[model samples]
Target: MSKKQHRGWGVGEQAEQHYLVEPRHLAGGGDVRHVSEFLRAAGWTDQSRTGGPLVFDSPARTVHVAYNPFVRPGGWTITGKANDHEPEWNVTFNPQTPVEIVAGFTDALTKSRSAHAPNPWAPLRQHGWETERAQHFTAVSPDRNAWLQFHQTGEGQAHWWAGARTEHGRTWDAVLTPSTPMHLIEAFSAALADPQPVMRPRGNIPPSRWIRTTSVSVRPSELGAWQQARISAARAATWARNSWASSSPRTHTPTPRPYAAAAGAVRTGR
Candidate 1:
């Protein structure tokens, strides 16, 4: 889809094959539930309980993810604290932010990485977004309601950070600090800027909100398929993370050089 918002209203294709993934918030609406589910499956420590914020910490305690209904009912708080003091990088998904979209960020986060740096702009450029500086490197979405800025304007602003934002009643935003991993942020950018049309019951697109939407319909079966695909993907990612963990190289401590001249010790045979 050339534009972020489509032209009309309709049901979304529920099947995995027919899916054109986009932020669920953009589609109709979304929640962090699925993201939390995936994180648990991927081995994150879950500290949340019934009717409270959704919270999880990366196994090493370096990263934290929170979906708070108390503080920011519509936002998600994610931070990386490798030093165990200050955050290396922080990405916050503002209220109304789609969990699925944010999942794109987490999806890339939990997986392994390559040697090259991430290019957050590739996806947007491919979608025909132009790049410029509004006091920072930024890209505007097709409908002009959203933005991707290289430097966030809030708390973690000084670091090598970037952000994604949206306006309107269902507005949402994201920010990353300088110390944040570039590769991970790249995944976030790609997810936000994806051009494929995602299925939405069409929130923010009807007459009241006045946003464009693609003409489409959803069948009951397809919806089931879509849900299935999402669950399957989550499980697969969990397995991949576990496999990676188990296969990671381990450091071996060499025995102290055989105690030289042990006092009154018999010479040991090799």
Candidate 2:
């Protein structure tokens, strides 16, 4: 079969291009303060606002996300500290749920097929979507493949996920929204593509009315290592589940103050 050639430059690989809301940058230094102030004036608390890409108001321009060299420097610096400057801002998504609107834009802009298709290229997303890059949005699944393969196709620059918060001093600048919705779809798509088996059966007959049970045996010599690996995998899964669970926008749950509690204990000389 003839290979499918992309018509032009192909869809934007950047994840921010998929966000639904406009997550604009506030420049750096004073600009950060200004955007924070703007959100405050709009009745958003410092704890509620998020930092991310600056989706341009214009359509002709391809959306670009800014990266702070100090925070995440590219390539080896030859010598000296890797990244010296603290991260100024990142293309983060706000706590807004159901990234469908942004996803729609992403689907419109990008040429990425679902993660399951025959030609699966690595997903291109904002740098911080992975655990190592982001302060908050860590990879939920243990498989890094899902995080790596996901991409976003959207308009604007960034999004302000509503009701989201970050570990950075409860500042709105800490939380950010992805611009395109397609990035989320890509993440989910890649996750679905994982080699793990589905609990449901594929046969034409409906599932049995009752649950079935089976037993298996393993070599005693290998049991120790096997069990250890299983335990580790379980822990990873639990962490991923908890991470995304608490981030749900629909929950409206109050954030726990573990930091505050620790700080209070220290102050009281406990």
Candidate 3:
């Protein structure tokens, strides 16, 4: 009989692999009780409750929820592992995390574990952003004047951009990251619906207010013609101005030339 070689394989190694396979972070304000309830509802076993951090165990994972003294306004750090492994998965929730987002994370985590797949964007999708591609999505406000875009980073983090065009043709834009609270996104969406100007991040300029003015919405196919008409009008105005500027009193102001006729040519598609 051949002697069997003994290679040391242990629980710690399995735990490390499990954690490394799917790591996620969710940060903002949240309630511990809500988190605890969520864990219980997901069927995680209560392991240790006697001190430092509350512990929960799953068939192949361990979780710890503890108060983070270093975070302001008091926050909790939730960590997960395959089973007491090194380099555990961590997510922090601060005071700014809404209750709905906390619940959404729990649902996403549960789905990920059972499906054997990672879906970190579940919460965002639930909030009405339509996915365009993997980790990319766009949300347009009802008025069509404002839009929000989300782009996921290589590390599975998220980047956000919000833009709005005012009635006067001025544009406002902002770039934000996951570290910013979700409430800000909601606020931006609301501001886009109304006429109020959104404050830009870097400048001392005042907010851009929209004026109720006459506007025209041109179709993409008709844009060229509209542009040509505007160009003709500009040229006519320049010619009239130059003619008047170069003329003496004897010129009689060029007999009030037909400037509108030239502009009307393009508008009439002639």
**Pairwise TM-score winner, candidates 1 and 2:** 1
- In angstroms, the error of model 2 at 90 is 7.9
Candidate 3 per-residue lDDT over residues 70-133, each given as its tens digit: 4454444455553432334555544333323333343334322232333333433444434455
Best by TM-score: 1
Give me candidate 3's TM-score against the actual structure.
0.31
Please report, in order, the local distance difference test score of every candidate based on alpha carbons.
0.58, 0.25, 0.38
TM-score of each: 0.68, 0.17, 0.31
Count of steric clashes across candidates, in order? 13, 37, 5
> Which ten-residue region of model 3 has the weakest summed lDDT?
15-24
Better model by lDDT: candidate 1 vs candidate 2: 1
Error of 3 at 129 (Å): 1.9
- Model 1 vs. true fold: TM: 0.68
In model 1, what lDDT does residue 161 have? Answer: 37
Q: Which ten residues in a row have the lowest lDDT in candidate 2?
A: 18-27
